[model samples]
Target: MTSPPQPAAGPVSPLNSPLEPESNRKLAMLLLAIVLYIGVLLLPTPAGLTPAGQVALGLLVLVVTLWISECVSPANSAVILTGAAVLGLMGKSLTPGARPMKSADALAAMLGGFSSTAVLLVAAALFLAVALKHTGLDRRVALLVMSRVGISPARLTLGAMIVGLVLALFIPSATARVGAVIPIMIGITAALGLPINSSLGATLMIVTAQACSIFNMGFKTGAAQNLISLDFMQKAFGRTVTWSEWFLTALPFTASMSVVLFLASLFLLRPQVPPAAEAEAKLRAQLAELGPLSGAEKRLIAVAVLLLVMWSTEGVLHPFDTTTTTQIGIALLLMPRIGVMHWSQAEKLVPWGTVVLFAASISLGTLLSKTGAAGWLAQQTLGQIGLSALPVVMVVGALSLFSIVLHLGFASATGLASTLIPIFIAFAQTLPVTKETAFGIVMIQSFVVSFGFILPTNAPQNMLCYATGAIRTKEFAKIGLVVTVAGLLLIMLLSATVWPMMGVL
Candidate 1:
């Protein structure tokens, strides 16, 4: 009656049966992330270490822990990590002559990120994204491009990439670009008479994400996070990156990578055939009935262009700095009560969590450097590797890969960059790679971190496409791997030759 020695008859089963293959895979990844984190601790170099090392090690630990827990959402993880780091500082881990945590001081430090120019820009970008959605400006623009390039699925994918890149200049957030482009992509699939679930659409989404991340380098306001990286470079290495100079150096590489990404997508995304001529005609008629750009759309477009002109001609007009651009742009849109979207509407459009993440990540980066964690990390990890240009390149590549793989578990691109770029700077200095190589690699990471195709969470855009079931997991894997490899190679080539010539490194 005692359960007859249940499970003793054979090898006892786990209380929770051994994980399924997928579960086991996840478990392995979690374990691997932990192991890599510990490796960060053991690394040592010639430069004697300090409190900075401890902070960097702590950050690595925090990232792995968040990955394991699936904690307070992806963006929130940044807030938590930053908060923890600041608390640790107050606990004598960061500051010497340590005193009890001051509520006023901690509050100021934590709030500093929210008050940063970058966060405001992202908030404004998100608001504009909402306005774009309400007025259907993005859809109209994307569909028009599709109509012109509808001859082939490959061409359509390229067109989507172009549109995303163009938008990247106006919309600083990857999330905003993805949100804007996703509906238009779906509309294109439906209009082409192709299966809504075709791999082609998924591929197109990936292209948009990657291209958006890559081409963002061409414009100062393209990615708010890039400014963080630039700030670190300047503060750490005494380098100044002018908007025009950065654009000049980054454009060729971004352009080259875009072309390569287009080809890679074409090879990977095999599309289903288009619908019958009559069906296509009927769909076109329905789309036409929706009518041309509404007055609201025109107004939104004008505001967007006005914002762009300000960002682009900042040197000429010099009205407000990049930071003020966000506040100004949002005010212009929100004040005018632009079309259907009122000031209240802007509230919903902005991802406050993301803004918080931006703040938190910047705060974290600042702490790492201020606490000397970054320098310690550089000494420990890269110090022993031997100073050589090749070794530095290897370090950059390794860091890029590390950030990218971590992206699988992260839902926010800014969050991923915020967590990893500080660690990267720590290690980058130890390498013999030129300044340009280091900068380019770090920039490339903004693109690589969003590159995976394995799951919907890899990027917001991918998730949107996945919702349509247009992409099989296997298809995403194949396309993602190819694009990822192409991106790395392009980064390497540019770092080796192009960036150096531009007087960057």
Candidate 2:
């Protein structure tokens, strides 16, 4: 759903350079990963770090290096990690001394990630995204929201963000939401005869992308990474965080950031010239051409609303969890009477690779936690730096800063979560705090996993929006860095006050 290339709003020469060939780069990165893995393996196992833990740490380094360098696709790289774990972690014991893990047992433990309901939930989300696209419901919703706004720059920018917030609920995949909603944004810029290269045009696209990231934390199903974080949190803390509960916790941060994002576009990245007075008319006209909702749209709406009710009422009106309810919702859509879309239709749009990658990532994180590698590594790093000795707010601040800087090297937040979340979960555990406070630390940091706010390459949706040629990497960074800092301060606020009040911090 990417718009065709539009006129670039800013200079690009600053970001371009000659680079090595792709195959050569892959070979170089793979070699670097192998070196790091062997380096870890050769390191004398520190006290309390068993042989198995050391091997797990080695595998973590190898896979992360590969992922960061794009040496291999994340799914295949995960497959490598799994195969390695099956062989590498079949040890005599998990602790200093214990019962031996049989080869079959090692294989089973390594594959637990694929068996997790989170994988199925992600697959279910893809199916739902496909069904929405098949019915064109997502695009209609976006346009309907856009149709309601006046043509002022402030109104148009706010309209784009509202579209993102609303679509984030209905369209679970961030890229899919951008695909459905942003072409309309581009069309509006085009219709206004505004070169996307202009300040107004570029900011419009950037905010559309940023808004997707903002609300990715707002809803449990907003992004795949959110589920990744949730999976880690539940495993570490052994408690469920229901859909409504997550919404209530995230509302203050997401809502405040939404307002900040709007203001930034208006004052910080002001358009060179105001859009034509006819912009709203064109938006409504495009929405009008879609005409009345189709039969499929109506049925899809009903199913969506029913699912929303079920999701909101979980633990209150019913015992069904999010994964179960989502599966039920998709099943209804595929059924004969409901008939939102055929399995064949969804099959075409559904991203099976994402499901594979997500499952594999979980396996990687699971290996880290189960083998005690994460805890030992946390002891080595966070403990070494005395982060645990800092004040509670300072601990959060330092962690947030670390997460932001680390995010510069990561392209996929899901990959970042799979790598760092387990360690942080262990970091929380090792903190000299109550079991509840430790759990709270993990919960609060999970929100930081959505911090793909500093680079165009940081997220799939950012890359998708960047393809429009409306925003240069440098220009995007200007807005992204500001949002990243603002988001960090907001998290600090929540951690200091609201999250603690809610027993989350």
What is candidate 2's lDDT per residue for 421-477, written digit by digit as tens? 899989988788888888767666777878888799888899998998999998889
Q: What shift in Å separates residue 63 of candidate 2 from its native position after superposition?
A: 1.8
Candidate 1 on 47-81: residue-level lDDT in tens? 55444446455665766566544544657566656
Model 2: ten consecutive residues of lowest lDDT: 11-20
Clashes of each: 6, 2
Candidate 1 clashes: the total is 6
**Looking at candidate 1, what is the lDDT of residue 402?**
65
> Scored by CA lDDT, what does every candidate get?
0.64, 0.83
Best by lDDT: 2
